[model samples]
Target: MQIEIVEVLDQERAMVAFNSPVGSAAGVWKGGQGLETGTHHVEFEIPDEVHSWSLVQPTHGAITGGGARGGDFVTVHGQVEGVGEDSVVTLRIGPDVIFVEMEDSVERLNQGDYVTFNSPTVEIYPYQT
Candidate 1:
C-alpha cells in the first residue's frame, strides 16, 4: 500500500498515515532507511508478538494509536489472511497484507477470521515493485 511519511521520529523511524478501502490509520515506522516526508509504497510488519487478539464482528480495518500498552503502541483491526506454522499470522488490513508475529500459537485462527489486537510496534518498510 502507499503511505505518507508524515513525521520522522528518528533516524530509522517515522510516523506514517494512510487511507484505504477499510479505513484510515497512523502508525510508527518500523524497518527501512530513513525516509523523507513523502508518499511511498510500503509493506507493514508487526515485530512484537501480539499477546491479545480475538475474533470480532466484521468491521472496517484500521491501524491506530493509544493501545493499552501505551507509549507508541498501536491497535490493528483486520481479517486473518493465514496462519503459518512458524507463528507468523498474515493480516489483511484495508487493502494491505501485514505480517504479524503472534505471541501465542496461531492454532485458533482460521482463514478470513476478523480480528483485532494491540502491539508494541508497527513497522513499515519501503517496497519496490
Candidate 2:
C-alpha cells in the first residue's frame, strides 16, 4: 500500500490518497461485466483535538426479496503526525512509514469530506497492465 498526500485543507483537514497493488483479479469485474480500474482515494479530516484516527471501511448492500443484503466489512487504521510548517504531514499505510507530501489549506470540511473515502464505485484493475 502507498499513501500520497495530495493536499492539506487545514489544521483539521487534509487530502490523502491511497493506492495498493492488486494482488489478484478474481473479482475485479463488477457484475461480472466491466473491468475495474482506478486508485482508491481516502481523505481524512483530523479534528483539532484528535491526534489519531481509526476508521472502518463501509459496507455495501444488494436488494433481494424487497430487502437489503449486506457485504463484508474491513477496518482501516491511521495515525496523525504533527502538522508541519508546510501544514502537511505524510504517513504510510503499512507497518513501515513512507512519506508523501501534498498541498495544504485552511478551509472547513463537512460530511462530504469523509464520504470521498467511502466511495464504493472506485475500482482498480491490475490485470490490464
Candidate 3:
C-alpha cells in the first residue's frame, strides 16, 4: 500500500487524499495542528467501505517534558481489514486519546507526515522491531 500527498495546508498541517489501486475509491484528510480549529471533515468516496476500516485507541500511554521518561510512546493498536484498498486514513482526537489535563484545541498526535489531525502537540514515532 502507498500513501500519496494531495495537498499541504501549512508546515504544521496538510490536506491529503488517498487512493488504493486494489479498489477504485478515495479518502480525504483535513484539519490538524497548526491548521484550523473545528470538526474537520473527511469524505470517503466509498461510504460502503466505511465499515471496512477499524480504529485503534491508545492504550496505557504517557508523555513527559523530559527524556527522563525514556521516550514518550503511544500505541494505537488495531487491525485493518477489507483485504485490499488504499485506505485514506484520518486521525481524530476523542476523549480516549486526549489527556485530562490537556486544554488545547489541537493536541499533538502520533501520526506520520501523511496523516493529519487538529492537535497542537503530537510527536509521531515509527514502530521499531
Candidate 4:
C-alpha cells in the first residue's frame, strides 16, 4: 500500500496515513527503515503476538489508529483468510494482505470470519522494485 509519512517521531517511528480503497488510517510507523515526510510505497505487518479479537458483523474494511483512537496502536477490521500454526493468521483487508501472529492459537477462527483486533504497533517496510 501507499502511505504518506506525515510526521517524523524519531529515526524509526513516524505518523503515517494509509491510502486504502476501503478506508484510510493514521498510524505510527514502526520499522528499522528511516522515513521522511512524503509518500512511499510500503507493506505492513502486525508484529505483536495478539491473543484476542472480537467477532463483528460484516462491515466495510477499515484501519484506524493513533491519537485519540489509541496511542501507538492500530485497529484492523477484515475477513479472516486462514489460521496457521504458531498462532499466525492471514487477513484480507481491502486489497492488502496482513499477517498477524497471535499469542494464543486462532484455531477457533475460520476462514471468511469477519473480525476486528487492535495491535500495539504496525510496522511498515518500503517495497522494493
lDDT tens digits by residue: candidate 2, 1-129: 222222221222211122333111111112223212344332222222222233334322111110011222112222333334443443323332322232423122222121111111222122221
Candidate numbers, best lDDT first, in rank order: 4, 1, 3, 2
lDDT of 4: 0.71
Model 1 whole-model lDDT (C-alpha atoms): 0.71
Best by TM-score: 4
lDDT of 4 by residue, 1-129 (tens): 766665564444465555546455565565545567677777777777787888899876667775444456678888988888877788888777888886654777899989888877666777655
RMSD of 2: 14.8
Candidate 4 stretches with Cα past 4 Å from truth are 11-34, 67-72
- What would the per-residue lDDT of candidate 1 be over residues 1-129, giving only the tens digit for each residue? 877655454543455554434444556665556556777777777877788888899977787763222345677899998998778898888888888888665798999899999777666677677
Backbone clashes under 3 angstroms, per model: 2, 3, 9, 0
Clashing pairs in 3: 32-117, 32-118, 106-119, 106-120, 107-119, 107-120, 108-121, 108-122, 109-122
lDDT against the true structure, each candidate: 0.71, 0.24, 0.25, 0.71
Candidate 1, superposed: residue stretches over 4 Å from native: 11-34, 66-71
Q: TM-scores, in order shown? A: 0.76, 0.22, 0.18, 0.79
State the lDDT of candidate 3 residue by residue for 20-61, as single tens digits. Answer: 222111122333343332222232221222222222344322
